[model samples]
Target chain A: MPKSNLDLINDCDSFPYDTFPSQQSAFTGYYTFLLPNDARPHGLLTSATVQSMPWTSDFRIDHSTKTVHLLPASHNPADLASSCTSALSNLITKAIQTNTFPILHGKHSEPYPILGAPKGPISIERFARSLFGLTARGAHLTVYTRTVHGLSIWVPRRSPTLFTYPHCLDTTVAGGVTTGEDPFTCIVREAAEEASLPEELVRTHARSCGVLSYMGLRDEARGGGGGEQGLVTPDLIYVFDLEVGEEVRLEPGDDEVEAFYLWDVETVRRGLAEGGFKTNSAVVMVDFLMRHGVVRPETEGDYVEIAMRMHRRLPFPVSARQVL
Target chain B: MPKSNLDLINDCDSFPYDTFPSQQSAFTGYYTFLLPNDARPHGLLTSATVQSMPWTSDFRIDHSTKTVHLLPASHNPADLASSCTSALSNLITKAIQTNTFPILHGKHSEPYPILGAPKGPISIERFARSLFGLTARGAHLTVYTRTVHGLSIWVPRRSPTLFTYPHCLDTTVAGGVTTGEDPFTCIVREAAEEASLPEELVRTHARSCGVLSYMGLRDEARGGGGGEQGLVTPDLIYVFDLEVGEEVRLEPGDDEVEAFYLWDVETVRRGLAEGGFKTNSAVVMVDFLMRHGVVRPETEGDYVEIAMRMHRRLPFPVSARQVL
Candidate 1:
């Protein structure tokens, strides 16, 4: 049986992309093997899609041949170009630095309305897959708390009862925006569903919004039935800045959730560098928060580091594709 | 005969809302009333949306008491409640702000899906009585240019053919972001269509997008048959941000333009504030640019500010039903 969604996310945490063998590209055989088969070549606005994709290039001692053969179900096609090349490349580059990888697994090709109906939710299969691996149809909202001292943050945690993932800890408030839902609505809703926080609580410290993108070159088709098999796809990733204050309560919905907490700068830095209690997503998020001065190492006023060890393994290639 | 679309848009440059006293509204009053019969509560979500939204009491001026009604929309419904208290109260609030005294207009409802299909363009009549306004259906894009300098900006001069107040002349390029198009595609396409510039010339600076609500708000329910009332009548407006450098050659699309030029920050500040040009869009845009610090006071730029201004007028109280 396929792993649970939570389990897949845990997989990403367990085997991150940054830990791949990246001394050179030519020798990284398995890394290149998982190039997404854009059968139709369109991901964003087309058909045929595969989420939580995991590309692994195992390390072997065969110094003579230096053989890095493609793994199971892996294919390299001259025509099956990438809808989003940068996503893969990002994973590879990060992998060379570390040995683990991240992955996303979801089904595709939702039936849009032919007679003026809103496109419905993604397949249940896909949702389940995302829990196990890195899932598509998700959004990231960074809550930058402007406190008396400085800025603070609130990151959501993944629940254990999740249909897919199990042990892995992942993004704070990341989830799919169903066709009809707006991005803002999506984030607020997800934060509530997974963590059981009130909408009013989340909206209190709202500040500004921004977007982020993860993309690379385009390639031919490697997918067939999904959205990216036939058309052009741009690997896109956008993040919104959801600001909150230091005096907020995060009501963890169920046992699925362990707790809701606060984060500071140094703690974030330590987590990213030392790996005391986190994953790549946490590390990247820490880096981004640091860049914006949204999270500081210390704070005097209303601030608390809810989880000194809030990081969990996810099943994704948290690093880049090229370096691996 | 009532005004047609071309007359309202191309001729008057005002939005086509449900009018009162024959001026889009519920009652036919002395002033061109909005909100009464106005179907569009939010007006148009156009380029001007940013300037006139959220209806903060800060912008309102109450002369009766010669004071700011920090909460003019404040209610005293406790004394007057019977059967429909909830519905009545909500309506009163909406109505009070719907036409904020001076402008008498604000916010619009979601659009009625005028065009049946998403792939191609279709002529959509906002409303049967909606004939008092214009119906525009098209897409726009914001392309960017690159330079060693921080960033390039285009300020248009008020277009000669456009008898409207701000014809996007002080800006470099302007157009609509039609349905089914993302920001990247929209900007590039708009650059090509409005300025006759190459799509590549316009590059993207940031993905952070803001809403520009204009006065125009399309409502399709009154479009005679009332069968397809809930049309996707967007509060039509442009969503874009692009860059153009000193070296790029720009040719305004003749179909929608008369001439084109460039301006620097100082030039814009001096000209727009001093009434050197004939468009109001420039001033607000300059304010937007200035507030955002996208451009500074002194820089090697190109622009000519149009002497455009905002709708100084607003909504007032009416209705003998309550006042009676």
Candidate 2:
């Protein structure tokens, strides 16, 4: 870290540059870590200075408050440099091996407590998640409503018996993607378990659109993984978006779903409007259907552009662009 | 596989109604198999033929000996007049798995095949390949030359290679995608590995004008899994035609090349006039580039135009209408 700028810039001798695609300027310089002056692993620069760094400065490490801040610039880099710091060496290794640098999305980003200060490899899999799965690791079957008449969603009331959230109108099907199983095949099995839909439904309704990656940060200062929990989980979740025709009835595979409803579109609208929805995920589902132009008719056989209308109604926090 | 026509076409129970996106009859069914009776896996099938009675028919049980197979049309209502046969069971299972369907451009296939039977997933991986880090698994990279002065290739002792059968050079910078990576990133890596060209040079000198998929089957039986060897390897390769700066020097990556040479239209014309060259795959590449103006020279540079014209001088064997 003490080397002159020019010396550091051309110091490609330590690492075999030919082995990787990176050039001198394209590659970040060598990195190292130093312990806190107090020698307390948890006692990082937790002084109060970070509480109020220059607003115009990129960011500051508010040691007194243990707050890592950020200063959003008008012009972002073509490929933003991520602060990669992990309490776990494996996560750090994984980050470098995979050619991805992670940065915490929220405030108090530890690895990057000081703005513009170089950080190390960041793992993307460090956040709180409810329900998630990997292909072959899990499967799902979505029952789409097709009728113009009326419909209801069948759900099982949690018994307050299970360790996790119980008694909920759960998705018809989901399971681990045991190694070696194709995702499409897994979905069919899940659909049958959830809705008693035929395996054929899976074959016909097979929709392997694409995948999306989500990354976040975890801080040990907040009493998270600093010692044993230092750093966070690194993972890749494979998502499958699929649907089955409305004609399919929800068949009981187990006590998973005690019942389902065949609700009409108006009932859904009413539920959304009244803020009476049980789970936010249901809203996500409704939004997906609406975006794809699936909705109820104004009257039997009457029509309204559901997808367009729903899109217009939603307040988008992100820009209207595909996931980069 | 024994049942009357009445039991076959009219029997609702034997039909796999569940496979239908709609209970309509217009849609087709496809299937896939992980392995043959011997337990080796291959590829997925793109087509199928079924018997009409009791939906009873036996599909091809072995290589070079395929037969019609009938399967239940739907599982929603399993009320067939007779018990299902092994053939029927296999067919129905295949249909439900969606392995019976083939992906477009999934592999290089001839425009036509005589067996008239669909390909199978008879699962297997590459048997023999290059031993270096650049080969093996689903990952690897290769670099070829591209048109610079004016779009023409010069071949030197081209033989045994899949394209440029007679060794007339053309289409540089072509390469393969490596494991755990997508094609977009692989090609750029290939260029660097082969020519030591910086990414900026490659990006600025090249353009991803378009893409195409093909299966290069020939006038012989194709070996699959443990079956007899075929003349082709099925790969979903993406073709990228590049245009480089005229002054750039050529650097061959490995011993795979005998030597490198840059040729203009007259040079190429002289080579072909003296001998002629055109590998089946090379023919396809050239046809693709020419038909799309992907390697047009007049617009590229005088040398490039001359080189492109030299390609035209080759006895392409097929007419523009035929190849185009």
Candidate 3:
């Protein structure tokens, strides 16, 4: 049987607060990763990862409390950034050399900021974020056209050769919000690089329609592959809507996307019910349907729960002011 | 100093889960109100209110556990409804006669369903919701028009003679969702009754734009009047947006609204910062601003926090399926 719409949202927001205690008992348990001078835990670490830390004057692991504290060498923003980055780099290198985690092998030079660090924003390789259970921010845009029949959306299938969620359906354009990059710029850049959309058209037409947040659990059923499973993943996605004219054409700008499909509302709904779209992308699509009056309380019995679950309150501090 | 946009949201979602424990220590702790078959608490009752309950075989107030369980007369849905409603009606009458709670004096014949009731939906008077800390559902609609300068919204000033939040600003059209009405129907009816809007126009043009749920505390600072202060008020508002042509005019259909003003975005922003809107109305307005891209991460420091707080998870179940 196909999954319900509520199931799609639950797939993305699997780890609610009620399940935390139960999950702790079932798994090896996670350690709270706290930065210096911060009262809140900014990340989570598995027991094995906490034990493998070098403790090179930059970290303090407290077994009793199940916490790993980042000990910065200096209070200065510049000094803290460099010190923290170098320590994390060393840890990732050790993990790669020892074949401890295969996910780190996909790490690139791109640094994603750990939002709301005490002294300043700290940087970590994008691929390593899930290992620490850090919050990930990204921008996703849904491009559609209003045809005579109804609204049709431009959907993309991710490249089968890609490392994560290969061959899965995705939003028209989406990319991680890299360190020092705002969501607007990130979406515009992604639109051009991933969908061959003109910068001017995207800049002029993209409507910022708010955000969707969820505490996801990475697992094989939800398209988690080539990496560790059962990792706590907190994600905040800035959502955008773009209604393009019929003259506009969307082509695969790079190899990241395999192809594009212009699916109508019924087609999209059918695909969603069959779990054809990526987890987060399915959430975005549901949100679009709600905003466009497609999915409603009159039709969907789980309307209220679905809407509330899509905007789950993340555990970490997300104030952009904390970014350096 | 004028409040920022974040303050507008914080004013509505004031009672987050973090403050629940502290609030219990400061004030007389609240008792969890549970139905006989429910595993979760569906409402909250103040200690004083719990003590004053008639307890005529319809309730089981466990002082040690700080719980008030509703003991239904029978397992039948009709029997349960009458038993619960009569018991609550008696309670409200006693409170009104003894002047135990001023809020009950404003109670009417309208019955609001207790969503997610185990046996079936049992209802209580709408005005008595706060006394029992039950969730109140409503429908709010924002009407706007396109102009040469920018977008202009139809803002309504609530009637000065009203019982609650008199003379304050509200959405273009808003009203409580009665027991048997769905949100879409409720909004259309409210649009006609509140704003004198034609039913044809609203039914044709009103777009269901999702929902906004928040855990609000009823206090004087937040425009709560004619009632007891410091009551737990959980709200779920179904939001709709209608774009009218420039030729359309909005008139106050009834005494509920004193007047209507078509204010531009800047004017609305100034009014919001000046704290001129009601608490929930302010939240709805902020959502409108966000959906329209008037507020962005580039300008607002508390952008992410503001968005997340607006959708606080209500402690009670809100499934429409639970409503008969």
Using DockQ as the measure, which candidate wins?
A: 3
Q: For residues A1-324, write the lDDT of model 2, one tens digit per residue.
A: 232211211111111111111124211221111222111111111121122112233333343443333322332333223422223223334334553322312212112121112222222232211000100123344455545563343333333453233544343355544323444566677667755767775666544421111111224332222221122121212233444465566666655555566555555555444433323223333433322323322121111111111111011011112010
Model 3, B311: alpha-carbon shift in Å? Answer: 1.0
> lDDT per residue, candidate 1, A1-324, as tens digits?
433222222322222222111113211222111213111111221111222233334212232332222122333443222212323333334433343212222222221111110121212122222111222333555555666755556644545565434443445566554444544567677777766667786555332232222221122322212222222211112244555556655666656556555766544444444333223344336424523523322221101111111121111222222110
Tens-digit lDDT track for model 3 on A93-138?
A: 6666676666677445578888886555688888788889899998
Select the stronger candidate by lDDT from 1 and 3: 3
Best by lDDT: 3
**Ten contiguous residues minimizing lDDT sum, candidate 2 chain A:** A128-137
- List, residue by residue over B1-324, the lDDT tens digit for candidate 1: 432211222122232332111123321221110221222221112222222324343223333322211222443434211212222234324544655212222333322222221112212222311221222322233334445543344655556556334344445555433434443465566667778777555542422233222233223422222222112222323234444456766666755666655554545555554544433244335424432334321220111010010111111111111110
Q: What TM-score does each of the candidates earn?
A: 0.29, 0.25, 0.94
lDDT of each structure? 0.33, 0.30, 0.81
iRMSD in angstroms, per model: 25.7, 26.2, 5.0
Indicate the docking level reached by candidate 1: incorrect
Can you tell me which runs of candidate 1 are displaced by over 4 Å?
A1-40, A43-135, A156-170, A201-208, A215-237, A275-280, A283-287, A294-324, B1-324
Residue-level lDDT of model 2, residues B1-324, one tens digit each, is 432211211121111211101123211232222211222112223232222112223333232322222233442223321222233334334443543222211222211111101221111112211000001111122123445454454233433453224344434444544323444466677667655557776655443322222222222232122221212222333344454555666666644444556666555444433433332224323333333334232222221112211122111111111110
Model 2 TM-score, 2 decimals: 0.25
Model 2 Cα RMSD, Å? 30.2
Query: What proportion of the true contacts does each candidate reproduce?
Result: 0.00, 0.00, 0.66
Instruction: Sort by TM-score, best first.
Output: 3, 1, 2
Docking class of 3: medium
